[model samples]
Target: MEEVEVVVAHSERATLRVGEVFLKVDADQSRIDVEVEAMSLAPVPTPKVLWRKPPVLAIAALPGATLGRLGGPSTGSPAAWAAAGAAIRKLHDAPLPPRTGRAGRSIVALAAELDAECEALVANGVLPGDLVTRNRQVAEAALRPWTPVFTHGDLQIAHVFVDAGEVTGIIDWSEAGRGDALYDLATFTLGHEEHLDDVIGGYGTDLDLDLDVIHGWWSLRSLLAVRWLIEHGFDPFAPGCEVDVLRARM
Candidate 1:
């Protein structure tokens, strides 16, 4: 394996240049561990919300020529879902640092941010249509009785790293925060329905989470994701499809 040279550095960000690779470093802990990627850019922009404390564990680089192809399909398998669920559950159950009533930012702040993003999208000719309005209503309803649990705001397959049937590490903590736990589940199951049942099933039998609320928030999140993509130059009606399915189901 070749060692990548750290070419750019910031207090909270860095960039590494390898022979034929460019790794964008999002989080690094004391030069001992790092969360990085060789991709040209992240799929979504990081939110400007200050939520969780800096990560404790350091992520040592996994030796490989290509970091993109490191994880395989099995990461979404039933066994892998179980392992991921266990890991997520542990994260949620961990005693959260004292909530000053604002570590996660207020739901009102989130709505304001979403509205600003939506306006930017419309300005760029990416109309979110009725989806934007629907999201506002759903968000208001969901935030009424919010439970501030630790949530990996962007808990999707791409952020999970698996090896030999176990979750070796989780990447992309840029969105980590205190919010509804179900929102995390919704984000995880956004487009891939194949493993949703398994993922939800593995959430365990202890907590009595409201299914309707979860689905509602999931729908809203899907819309937000689509809007973001459109604003960033992606065609909403592209061959891959958009969040219409999620909207209809909601």
Candidate 2:
């Protein structure tokens, strides 16, 4: 019998692993379309799409261990992180996909949303008012203009697979789209700030990125994610978690 393992289950979506196949179910069909198209368009290695039917998309699981877990230090070597960086650069440098991706949210448009989220966090006591305020201020730097690039929208550490110091594959492309290039960099390096240099080293010196904007994204992303995580039964307040990331900015 093939045992079905729940990779993650939340209100918006769920991912199940049965043997070597991963089944993703989502209420939103458009998001699934984005995932399929992004996987097909990305220049970097991605899981093979076994099949797709409406709410269900099945993909063969890629080999090797994840780069790291959220809220934890990554065990991936500097070489592996560099390889991941190189892969991201390739994706960013690739020609834009024929269709726009889901990450089309503009920073200017997100300001109101970020303000509301921060206020809710303060009112709900999800984080210290001062901490939230400071981080919100820092996050403003990321609201400036940026040239859109092909981005993996949700480039969490765990989504990147590495084996023997090489990035074997990158999974989860639902948010892939034309967006700020630094946003991908920020998302990839979220809790793993210590390895930023290694990633940049592998990315090379061709492009000049603003470190302040990157730092701003760290604050912004951590702040906006807290309330949503709580509503979805996640504990972002745990040690070394999103709350800690915000507090670190103080």
Candidate 3:
């Protein structure tokens, strides 16, 4: 018998690692369905699905370390980051998956949502009023519509595994669905902005990306996530953390 390692335990989901097997227990079956189906459809490297039995998804552990951690400097070389970018590009270029209930967020709706959330943050005194306002303004550019691409929904650095400077696998496809491509890019570089060029270079084409929109997504993501993280008993205000990411945008 091996000791069960708690990889992450949140209200909606919990992941436990035992030996070479990782078990993800999610309360939402639709999320799990998206994960399983997306992995099947994605052209990029992903964890091997060992088995599934409602609420529990058993997967084989990947062979490499994660690309990096949020709020921490990445030890991955520029090449590794580039490889991740290339991998994401490949995933994006693949055929679209079947339409689940999830749809891309409309800019108008996103704007309204951002407005409400920013007001809540200020009203609750969760963050400085100026900081919230500034980020709210920055998030405006990202609200515009664009052709939807298959997005990993939550493409955090920790979900990307690299071995020998190559992206061996990506995990946590629960959020995989049609969405804005820049949102994926923004999420990847949220706390690791320095690696943006490496990521863009590896994406294997000039995307003519609007830097402002990218920055906007960064602000929007951090702002929205801060409250959730805090409610979950996780501190986003830690030095050089989510709060730092938002402040950096200012």
Candidate 1, residues 16-76, lDDT tens digits: the string is 6555444554455532121222111222222122222344322334321211211123335
User: Please, what is the TM-score per model?
Assistant: 0.63, 0.96, 0.96
Task: Show the colliding residue pairs in model 3.
Answer: none
- Give the Å shift of residue 8 in candidate 3: 0.6
> Which 10 successive residues of model 3 have the least lDDT summed?
96-105
Per-candidate clash tally: 0, 0, 0
Which segments of model 3 are wrong by more than 4 Å? 100-103
User: In candidate 2, residue 51 scores what lDDT?
Assistant: 91
In lDDT terms, how accurate is model 2?
A: 0.88
Each model's lDDT: 0.53, 0.88, 0.87
Pick the winner on TM-score between candidates 1 and 2: 2
Give candidate 1's error at residue 12 in angstroms: 12
Model 2, residue 121: C-alpha shift (Å) = 1.3
Candidate 1, residue 119: CA error in Å? 6.2
In model 2, which residue pairs have backbone atoms overlapping below 3 Å?
A: none
Off by over 4 Å in 1: 1-23, 26-59, 62-75, 98-103, 114-125, 128-141, 231-250
User: Model 3, 143-201: lDDT tens per residue?
Assistant: 88787788888999999999999989999998888888889889988888999999999
